[model samples]
Target: MTSPHDALFQWTFSQREHALGLLKAALPRPVVAAVRWSTLRIEKGSFVDRALRSRHSDLVLSARMGAGRIYFYVIVEHQRDVEALMVFRMGLYMMRLWERITRDRPRLTELPPIMPVLIHHSDTGWTAARAFQDIVAARGPERAALLPHIPCFELLLVDVSAGRAGDVVEEALTALGKVVLWCLSVSGDDARLEREIGHVAAALDEVLRAPSGLAALEALLRYLLATHERLSVQKIGGILEKAVGPQAQEAIVTELDEIERRGRAQGRVQGRVQGRAQTLLEVLTARFGSVPAEVSARILAADEATLVTCTTRVLTAPTPQEVLGDDGPRVSPARRPPARKRARRT
Candidate 1:
């Protein structure tokens, strides 16, 4: 299953208005007031470590400030638990960004300063270090002395659990940011998600006013389906119809139905296959220390019936061979009609 938190965060902040609003909300009031919001330009790709990219999604936005430019690297961390290595990871990403710029722009004399912002929305809240030096092993005077040599960076923390996200959205002057924040804040709770459907609808209405209105609507519909279990095709379509006019609703709902149909079908198939595979593997592991390649391949490739049979046999069978033996129950033959009946009628 696609993680709801990850999906929502990526979809929301990908939009320019929402990202701009996020920056304003997360940054210091003095820093936020200094910049021209209109000049905010999103940097296309991320420089985060590939291994950790699956859990942490990032976006880099840069803006013109007089003769100089400033870069904002927004790192969205979706994991529920505290990540001890987060500060180190952030530092690495910053270095990678600088490396890429240096390599790409060889003649440029100066690299724009990068400000790293960390947004987390875990239920348990953040308990990890906010600075790179905090996580390091060195301490006392030695640590203080080494600080000058070491790259020390502080993360601007936005803990969504503390209600900053909701406040940001409500306070934002734009519709896109409000909608994006609305989706992110209520993603974890089914009851809240359902209750706030009207608000989401209103936000969608606002989003649909832009030139790329239809495209935006489609994105929102997809995000809702991917993140929420309670939103069926029919429920979402109905909600859209009410929030956005019937014309917009018709366009979005058709796509939503097809996407949901495929998603649910695939989910069911994957769930069954994984459940059976795990059960078989567990049983084999319990009886035999290891499962040979051929045995594992057969078990994994087997149909539902074959898995059930093997699962039953594993409990009583003395050897792995017996559990997966060739000599087993054969499928029943198709029944044949009485031979004499046709001849008698003729």
Candidate 2:
């Protein structure tokens, strides 16, 4: 079975060059030219472990700019959903890179800047770092406050659900975006989204055959189809067949099928465990008003049989106190716990 980490690694490495081209287009002219002047190295695995400990980042690109006098690092983290830890993780990576560079080149006068870019397909609004208080305080109270300003991370948020069929390159990016959004969307009518996604997929098929775009498109499509649960290999393959050719479509389908089989097996095991835990928690909450944090944690960590038994007890228990063994409330099963006390904590 291919782990999420493995899948992510494959996805990132596959599109490393294509993503680099996109980044180059977005960078300042001098920086882009200077960076291009020197060799751009794609470093993966333990090389970047000090910066990003996990394999979640799709690509890490580093190059020497300014006549090979300075080193610039760009870390691209890709995701189908919003992760709260992204900010902290990027901050950690930046700090680690700085430390390593300084330690390695102690005599250097200055270090190059680091840019963290998030390529996300979430429909949820994206937010960057807040600088209101910091900016205001920098000039207001203590002129010497001297707090280092937080670096601004760029967010390339493309929500496919908001786009329509258009230019090939734009459509390709949108289609990739939609494929991700489709995977993450869990509510309402998905028919429209699916239809649009198919259109994008068809466009991607043609892009994959083009000499200039073929490699990148194939890599991106492979990654999207493999990691996203919403995209089936058959659907994507059909699109590829229409866009590219049967031979390429067959190869992609085979790879996707293997990935899906592994993912499904793992998902089934996880789902069973999660379902039982949820059932236990629901039952406990019903009978005992609200499950305490410690109790909930215990439930989550409990074995499957234990959770199943707890669920059974919850269904049969008449009152809150019965399930909790006399320590809980004596309220009816439908009665909820106190508003303030029952609120869930992270």
Candidate 3:
């Protein structure tokens, strides 16, 4: 199963403020100073290659400069593995974005500039080429001569693996950025997750003070419960209670109960619909080689949609932890971006 990191990473950036803050912090200081963060806007309905949607997940955010004539495209890459042809893929996506701009403004003659930023979170650090030209095969002077024809753009790479947990969480400009980077850093390591709960909880309290903080807190709690297997609902809720307040703890417990209720209710219907359950069990058995009783029991009880999601993830997920998506306290909210009204358009 694919790691839930993709979904969680996308969710964190879906917030306009979080996206802006992360870009400012992750980019160079000089670059950050030049842009008008106030004008930054996430360009919705701007993705392409619909048929290859499962290949990757990306975010396209735009901000204007110089009387709105110049714009910047911040394309975020959140894949786990490094793609050597990333430059080519970025080039293709940029071309599609430019085409989209021209279609929207037929009178324009020049396309706005775009800065591609790749947010990589692999266990191993990124060793791939940063510039598109690096991937091109040409020898000696031929490479220099062809430089004019080849794309020379350099993508800003934010390697999550290359930072200390303390520095990243403490220094991140946005609360959401801190939360995400911290989680990503400790994703596969339950020991680190437990050790750093105090720090994470402290940062979360700061995030919880704002008006929209509760929803963000809820999302974070859900993300933790889904991804961290060693964390129990009581354990997580206790950490949150100590860090935030009893209110937060109670909310988390309530959500946990709801998820369990839904899962079991779906289980009954699944038992009656033997065909889909059988298919799911077969897939699980093939991958895990005799699924554990508890896990098999869950499959027998899960709804068709959850089974489908698990099946899709099982194809690439390395462990039952990933296929189940959440092995801790609760199931994740439906596999979709959190629904909220768009912020004011730039």
The numbered model that scores best in lDDT is 1
Candidate 1, poorest ten consecutive residues by summed lDDT:
161-170
Candidate topping TM-score: 3
In candidate 1, which residue pairs clash? none
Worst 10 residues of 3 by lDDT: 161-170
Could you tell me how far off, in angstroms, the CA of residue 146 lies in candidate 3 after the best superposition? 2.4
For model 3, which pairs clash? 1-313, 1-316, 1-317, 267-301
Please identify which of the two predictions, 1 or 3, would achieve the higher TM-score against the true structure. Answer: 3
Across 1-346, the per-residue lDDT of candidate 1 in tens digits comes to: 3455556666767777778777887777767877778889888777866777668888888887667778898887756567888888898888888888788889889887888998776666678898887887887778768888877788888766534454343564357666655665555465666666676576667677667766666666666666666767677567567666665666676667667788889999878977997888888888787977777888888877787788888988766667887564333456544457544664
User: For model 1, what is the alpha-carbon lDDT of residue 162?
Assistant: 34
Ranking by TM-score: 3, 1, 2
lDDT of 2 by residue, 159-216 (tens): 2323411211342233333333333332222354344445445545544445534444
lDDT of 3 by residue, 48-106 (tens): 35654445567778775665533444444444567788777877888888888899999
Query: Which should have the higher lDDT, number 1 or number 2?
Result: 1
Clashing pairs in 2: 287-320
What lDDT does each candidate get?
A: 0.73, 0.51, 0.69
Query: Which is superior by TM-score, 1 or 2?
Result: 1
